[model samples]
Target: MRRPDVALVAWGLLGTVAASLALAVAGQLPFGLVVLDVGIALAIAAPIALRLLGVVIPDVLVTATLLAAAGGVVVAHTALAARLAPRDLPLLHFAAALVIALVFMPGQAWLRAATNRLVLRRSRHQQAALQAFLHTLSPELGTLECCRRALAELVRVRQVPGAAIILRDGEAIAHGDFDLAPLVHVWPRGAAADALPARSFGTIELRALPLALREALVRAHVTLGAGPILSPRRRWGHLFLNTGMLGGFFHEDDVEGFQAFVAQLALLLDGADLLARTVAVERSLAHAEKLAALGELAARIAHEIRNPVTAARSLAQQLSREPGLPWVAEHRLILEELERVERRVGELLRFARRDELRFEPVDLGELARATLDALRPRLDAAGIAAGLEASPGVVARADRDKLRQVLVNLLENARDALATSPSPRRVTVAVRNGEGVATLSVTDNGPGAPAEVLSRLFEPFFSTKQTGTGLGLAIARHAVEAHGGAIVAAPAEGAGLAFRVTLPLAETP
Candidate 1:
């Protein structure tokens, strides 16, 4: 558009015309004049018509006219006086014109191609930078605010105008200038039409924008492309971008760069996800340490407190017996309540104590049955039928008392769960020997633990039960761990909660 540039292009074209005219006149006057006149006239006419009559006239028309004029001049000059003709001059001129045209053709093509390659190379560099940034960012920045700022910086560096990122949990933490109503409103149509795939990130064509919105977008010159931010489990969510006239309307380079951006972004997202998991794991370990400390302290305190509780209960009983007191029954109830308090305190002390186990060879099958027998009265009271599937003489290396306590706690929890369900409550305790270990499962026909609770089931003081101190499972976990085994909760395939306890089998002497 600059005057000097325009003048240079015009001078080159005019020089070609002048050379053709001179060749015609010097060799054969009439024929040369006709060819020159026609070409020159058309060359001058085309641009004026283009300005006034618009682009309907093809560029090919001008090129063709010039070629014809040059050819005509050559032929006329060749036919004239042979000696004066410089016989090969006309052919040389024509060949030269053709060679010039061919050279310029390739030059223009090379320039165009080079421009495209430059864009692609720059895009790749930008993408690489993004990947590097994300890899470092995930660990250092975990909050949404950090993610948002990082995202904004990425878009800014890429020279994109507007973009939005949606996390897997349906939270759209966004950055840049974008009205999401268009995207939200259009997503159903896009989804119904399979515009976005179920679990992968993808791109939407700018031309694919809804009619009215697309028109408005075009006016704003906003173009968009999207791809998924994938993690191992699933895609986080669709990343929507409005590249607001920069980066030039979704070219091949832009698409490639966007895809590379997503790939790197996904890596960061995965790191963020892993970092989150790590933080959670660390938190859990801290809580467990605290609980273990508390449990140990409680056990020691319980040992100390039991002696006094026993003395107080004995004194209360003697006082009750001695009464011609008006409220003898009430006094007896108080003594009973004192006894119950002692029992609970005993359980807590047991949970906290680090008692060395008396490991001995024992039949797990018989132990399982005895545990069920002790809880039979409670199961009957709760109207829950108890079933046992035992592999007899399955020997285990464990403290018999402690292992039996584990089973009893499991059964009691099952009975409590069954009490809340409708009629026909059922609980099953299954024992089997597999591979190198003995497995015991206590399953009940009741609603399973809620998903949220499942995450913290072994955590101390975390219970959903109204009267639960949240220590039962915590205690059971400790006992199993003490025996060099594991206790885990899983929803039963049948009707209720299933507690699986595993212990290594005793090696034959």
Candidate 2:
């Protein structure tokens, strides 16, 4: 710091010596005048010396300081050269030097501000950081790696106490000289807590944090501030930074610059999230299409084999009924096996068919009552207390037999679910009509399906049971969809599963 001041002072002195020598060579001034001129030049150069040493001065202060220095120089020079005649006195040179000093003061202030801005704005380090960040943020970059690179680049270029953070969804990554363990460990807690400031980006206090995190910051001798990285659509995460080393606080400009960087990062996060979701959706659509193709093939194969299976079953039945036949016992077993295959083939046919519906206005209340009555024997045998509730006037447009098949399938499934339950076994069926739709729900107090099983509950050939052919719910779905309705299964309010079927209502005539 002192080196620049020394050099500036030496240069000023050399200029003074050269001026003295030039005056002597020209024979324009006596020794007394030369001395006065040199003294004034040095006095006028005082502010320039201060500037060279990197001091920021307000315009008003600069003007006042320079004016004082100039006035002092003029007074001293006049008092020292008082013996010279008034006309011969070098007052003109002193006055000219004072004017230059006054001009230099304001000019230096403006020049300093401009130069600082140019240096900061066009800094090669910041540019390099941006380029590195772009290179790392290419489409090929993984989402987590992009976040990590962003943090690393910001921390490296900014040269603070090593601070950068990014969080997308629930995952987070951080970079800096300070260990991120404190923040990383607390992320789930921090993210879930509602105390985070609502500001988009700014310094946020961490005083209310957990003991371990606050202690970690204190031990590292750093004061931390949190800034939320957010786009207009979503908030990515909080960026925690310690802007200075040795626990120094951040200035307002530091906060603003950090916010700008955070905003850029938030956009990147948003793009990454959108890209991931797009890829997932595309994969899901492709999978669904593949499943549809498979189903069509299965239905075609089932249709072609139906005639053959029926012919074989007929031949086996004839063989079993043969009068005193030697192979009667073997033929009976074959006939039984044929019956099982026929039942399985029937299920496959029902699930694979997407046939057009035959909608008809049918009373759902009477249907619900009939279904419960038909299943009463099975429910009583399984020790399941079953009851049904159907609004008297509820009606719907559905294939009566198909809708009855759906209700029968759902009730049988519910009864099977409750068969072995150790808990209280009770099944309740409810039917209601409102808002232009009739809803039928079968709820059972049995062990409910888990999340993993619930996800594929309605998928064809996907079932949690050991002996299930996995087509009952699938067939039920087809039956309900054919009636222009929806069927959904979810865990009931208590520890049970509830299957709700909604069908569009037909006005009672």
Candidate 3:
């Protein structure tokens, strides 16, 4: 022992002996009573002395000492009572009971409190660790960022060298100087591990793991300690700590605190996910509102321009008929340009005006066939083969004109898409009914649009053609939605674009 420790021990023993002798002499107690009193004093002083020397006494040892001292006191009191007269026995017994109540009980309480304070010293900082972790949760940070920051905070609070968070999707965010890849590869999988409650794995437990996992952990110099981050709905991820190269382990208090922290982290992650989805929905709603306002503005502009364009076209036609006016070809070109403007204005008006649906049971198969027949001449002129594949009695609850307009727009769109394709180009319109829905698909053999272009196909005023108003698909979508249906575009089976429209099937009588 060091000189200071030895000197302190000597002084402690001397002081204890001096106090015991003083109690025996001053109280005139018998030798046996004096020894009993010395024993009791030592039981009470031992803990205080050890604490002063910075020694942490366990709760079990403290409890055992208190119980032993309490029993010894009772025995000493009984022996003293035996030496007393019969009349004084009851009074001595009463005094002994009072001493037990006033001393042993309170001493036990105090010692337990002191021992817990020493043994669970690290646990006292759990609140601080949690506060630090909570501070990392900021609205400006994303889920992954929050996770990384939380892991960083954990490393700091737990005094571990490194930590990592492995998400359910195999995405890992690591903080600290540790090899996370090997740990990730050896991470326990299957439902068993997922369903496990929060727990710690010490050095022996880690070494006892499967050969591959143990080898990986040993190679990476990481201590295997993890807690699952789970939610009522699904498993979020796992939190891992690298205790150190010495294969350290977590204390019971540390494990409990970690479990609480991970639980809080799981809640935050769930909230972050929910917030992201809500933000996306909000953005979609904002975009829709903007588009609605723009459509209204376009409608007003088209209304104002339509009147002047009509008057100009009428004047041009009249002058052309009167004679070879000085510039007849110029007049023809002016008339053609005016007609294009009028056509665009008409489309804009149709798009803006929400007409009441004239719902009726319409045969989708017949509609497909009729649309194909009406456009067959144009398809033939363009050397594009058009065919209809219809299922008998395939019908939908729709407005015939609106539904027909959708089909015409799709067919025309398909025809235009095939304008530059090689010979033997084909456009197939298929109509089928199943599961209380009618599906109409117009597919063609042509160069399909890229993914970037495909995403914006339904947006207002978004067109691939140079002279196209870009309102065709938009109008089609609006009409279909009015009838409580939907329209979608995708790449065709071989090479081209496919437009599919789904509408509710007509109810049977």
Candidate 4:
């Protein structure tokens, strides 16, 4: 199979041809010439024929035997045809060898091809299977099923007894022999790695990979193999085959064949990963587009609503100032209510419009006290006790109005939460000054937010309150981030919720 030992075949052919020609030339031999001719033909074809029958003989010996028989046939036939004398033998022998090589080499080649098909029947079968699965395997339902089918295809292609597909997410399926579990991501630590033999095929160390990969290889029983599942960017997974399934370990040709199949699987996984990311990006872009549209609509509505709101507030103020008005107190209440509506409308506009930050250094300690005073009436009405713990000279560089708005929203949320809190319905505003940062933590005695709702708290249109527009925390988060700060909400110790706002400390003046 390496290369035909042409010299050996020529010698064998020469000996057979010479022996037969000698008997023919002697002319006194019996009717044995015809019998020897048939024997010579079988002998010429036997070495190649033996290989086709799956008989393993030394390559050199088989080549020599086959070539010699072909040479014998040529010499015998030439001698019979020419019937030359012994002294003229040198030229005739040379002519016989050349004629055999030229005339029969083509036939030999065709015969060799025919025998090769027989010798490599399994390889041909594998090619057929790979071609079949090329169009059959698809990534649908899930990766697990698709990969499992791929494993089955490999089993067919390799003619292996069994195989397995172990997914990254912990699902495992087999070609027949493995009973995969619901999950097998966690590899056994320590001695449990010994279940599989310590051997490698390509770059895949079955034992060193994951547990699922190791288990699948050991079950197959072949270690000296090629099972590398590779990609240009990452390791998707691997493939393995049984060495003793139908025969022994995979031949050199088998190794070359599997490379293509494994590559296709790796490409599939890479494409799937890319597709998922693209879908996620598409969803995010659509969500952002919707948000942008809503922002424009909200901006227009706020501008239109502000006109009537301002006029109503001014009209109420003018009427309250009139002398001897019968409903002076009622008019005063209407003016106060109008002012509250105007303030609410202002918050709506601030939230809807993306205004650039008007950054200035502000004393957060003083601001916290002022915010509590402004909301003093609401606190009194709710029967909530308020307190402030401020570090001296706690200051931050931020947009004053926007930063105050974030604090007010946090405080208002806390106040509303504490409305039903027992006994000491308390709200604490604490400001801490540290190296290059200021942290404002607002805590209240109220039922804390659930763990499930904490993550989406800052997502626009997500809310817990019945009448809430759900923009408060979202707007607060936006404002804080605009000033290069961060806001986090979490359950407070024991009872209630806490909002921590951290901002960059202002340069000391």
Candidate 5:
């Protein structure tokens, strides 16, 4: 609710007195009727003030008060007329009051409407300034300093006594002189009684804004129309303001400007979110690149150091085979460990190489069959069967040896998974040509890779197996990527591991 403007009050009072005098003369009443007419005009003005101020001053109370006051004026005029024998004394008194009513209706309505419009225009100007302020909050320019600056500018431009931005996380932070947390936490959640059709009214306790501030607002004629700040994920706070004194209530335009201002702020917030995510992604990439370089260096060092160790161990094993060696078993054990180290070194070197591939048009079906045949001894030892279903002539341009290595890795993983699992232990290699692309999948009946490892499965030297170099899938990924293809691990429906590899077929010359 707002206080009435002094100018409007004065204008209504002045007009009421002058118009009441004219009506008195027209009805031929005596000059003494002027004071009576002025009194009646003041009575009418009070009720109109109460209505504009959003008070529930009942119509019956206004009518009863006016009728009782009018009755007294009538009785006095009738007594005076009886003494002087004046014509139409009762009619003249009634006419004066009617004139007051007629004059007050249009005058009061125009004043209220004009004041509301002025307030809306003032609010709109403030909103435009706030929109410009929000643009400065972009993180690309760096820091929350811009947001702080925007906050300050908002306070100054809006002439807001105080302003604050309270994050939904319950951070009670102030911007300029405004302390938002207290206001936000205690702000009304439901509808307002004086709710205008155009804008939502935020709850305002009369004590929160002083009469001086209210008077200044009415004097400045600031109007605000606003809505609650709400988000699907969280409760966003609202954009609202109290207009000091020049008050009639807000019109449609003020609400529109407020809603638009908040919408722009939301966009700025979204941009900040995107900028933060981009920074995170770049940091992740940098970290991944660093780790890849370190892995390559470690792999190279292993290859460089293993050859000499392997040669020395082979010599030791050969010498130990002679009858004179008392610790032959220990020497043999050393040789076996050295052999394992050599194998690991070879795996590392394979992972480290990033040389240009020697591309050739090769049949994926034939390549997969050959890989399976080579791993037949291991399959037999594990007591696992193999199923090969391939699309004929599914050719792609890639390094045949590298593709075969990828298939071998896939087969080895499938065989290992089968050995560890109960029930059926079988691996499937299926190749298909559809949707203008070729695909090959190796599936097995074993537990699927853990969700935690799935994202990092292609990373070098990350493995779950005790005796694994952890570079098998990583090398396989590198090989497929080199040929403009993709390989992915998925759970097999029936039982074990399933690896899907997709490749683009070569275009005909």
Candidate 6:
């Protein structure tokens, strides 16, 4: 028997002996009747009283104590009765033996089995409920959806007003009436592994917690039962319950259920994260394949159009050179239009063909300044104010000519965007060096493209401008990517568009 059970038996025996002695001293009732009353009361009422006091005593211990008390009572009664009437001793002995054999032994076993079934029935129901909840969590559900469903089920099972799931990165999903912001701030990264118990389920009483967390919980109007969602690799987040109204307590079965739920939730979160990444990679691969096929087709078509376009331009130029030709002005216009077509074909070919890069240490600040200087005449003509912001020694390993062309394209793109803007139309080019990379950006104070347009900005033949051939940005992207760099366009702060280029910094000797 456990220590508590042994103590309880000892105390119970002492109390029974004392009660019998008091009844004998009073001389109001027979000792046999007194013992019988005491034994029956203890057998029937002890379990009920202990349960009312929230003490969980095993039914086997109760049965054993009752049997020991009854045997003592029978022995004491038989000794006293034999002195009074020796003739009836055999009858008394036989009756006592018959009762012990036919009733007490078999009754104890049946009583133990019956009590156990009654006690464990609730626990079995709880386990079944938990299992059904787990089954509802399908693999296809996303992280937020999982959290929402889990919180809903927790509130239902635990009968709490609120619940929350706060991930390690500070993303939170909350359900019910409670405020979770304070809780989130206090347990943003969840409990540390070393701080948590082995089972990872713990109660958080307002008084027992640290002052700051306690105050935060008080402000949020909740006491907490929290479990870490952890795996062998890492802790994903925490699951929290509002247990203040529950007197900051959880049943043993509830704790076990909580631990199981969080363990499975961690695995589900991992699977969801992996699935999202897999989908993104698949999309990226598909887009790359599509772009490659489009580039190949564009190259073939450009090759077929280039020779005929060159011949037409040459013939138009020859016709314009004849001094006596009628409609000379019209002939000049034809030559100009053909030349424009030739330029577009050349841009298409550049965008389609991948050229071998000649990489060298190129000062990005200097390159920006030179590109701006070359475009100064056009900027003056367009009434657009252009300025450059550069940090010293911000250099990158790149093909100088190709990199120069990229800057020229971006600046011209910005200049064109600013053409219709109101007074003080401006373009700013900035260069700065960061960890292992150099960044250059050209920003314009002009109407920026919407998100839908921005997404297709670098695609060949995708343009918003009426007169655009749409190959400039596409070619710029190819050249920048060849040098192990990236280019992106976004709406600049306040107004207009910003195009940023990032390149790997040149290594220093």
CA-lDDT, candidates in order: 0.68, 0.70, 0.77, 0.68, 0.64, 0.76
What's the TM-score of each model vs. the native?
0.50, 0.52, 0.55, 0.50, 0.49, 0.70
lDDT of 3 by residue, 1-509 (tens): 22333455566667766766776778755764666566656645653454333323355557687777779878999789878989998888888788777666788767655664444333466557676667558645768988988887877766556788878776788998667778678766555456544454546566556787677666555554567887766677778777542224344665677777887888788888888889999998998788789889999999899999999999988988985469878988999999989999999998888889989999998888888888899999999999889999988999999999999999889888999899889999999887678999999999999999999999999999998989999999989988888999999987999999999988899
Q: Please report the candidate that would top TM-score against the real structure.
A: 6
* Candidate 4 TM-score to native: 0.50
What ranges in model 4 sit over 4 Å off? Answer: 1-124, 127-229, 237-259, 318-336, 357-464, 476-509
**lDDT of model number 1:** 0.68
Candidate 5 runs further than 4 Å off: 1-277, 316-336, 434-437
Which run of 10 residues does model 5 get worst, by summed lDDT?
A: 190-199
Q: What is the C-alpha lDDT profile of model 6 across 71-160, one tens digit per residue?
A: 875887677686867788777777777777654677676654454344422234555675578677875787788778878877676556
Which candidate model has the greater lDDT, 3 or 6?
3
lDDT of 1 by residue, 1-509 (tens): 22322454476558657867787768866766666666666655543443332222223434454567556655654554354556766666676567557645764455444543443223446767776666556454764654586578666767655677655555666666665655544343323333444332223454554566454444332345456665555566667665532133345555666777766666676676788899899998997799889888888877888888899898887787773766887877888888777877877887777788899987888888887888888788878899899987678899999888888888888877877799889988888999799998998879888778787888777778887867778888898998889988988886577889999888888
Candidate RMSDs in Å, in order, are 15.9, 16.0, 15.5, 16.2, 17.4, 12.4
Error of 1 at 116 (Å): 4.8
State residue 420's C-alpha deviation in candidate 5, in Å. 1.7
Error of 4 at 95 (Å): 22
Model 5: lDDT of residue 422:
75
Model 3 bad stretches (over 4 Å): 1-131, 144-259, 312-338, 360-366, 387-397, 430-441, 483-494, 500-509
What is the lDDT, from 0 to 100, of the residue 462 in candidate 1?
A: 74
Ranked by TM-score, the better of candidates 1 and 3 is 3
Q: On residues 1-509, what C-alpha lDDT tens digit does candidate 5 reach at each position? A: 22333455666667767766776778845653765566556655653554355322223334454566556666766676677544666666677667556545664555444443443234435776778777656666532444345556756775544344444443333454333433544433334311312334432432344455344333322334234344333334444454443323444565566567656665565566568889989998997697679677977798788879878877987788788878877888888888888877877878776778898888888888888888888897888888899989898877888888888888887777666787567788998887777798988877777778777777777888888878889889988977898988766785456788888887766
Model 3 gets an lDDT of 0.77
Worst 10 residues of 3 by lDDT: 47-56
Off by over 4 Å in 2: 1-135, 138-260, 312-340, 357-374, 387-410, 427-459, 463-467, 475-509
| Cα lDDT, model 4, residue 82 | 75
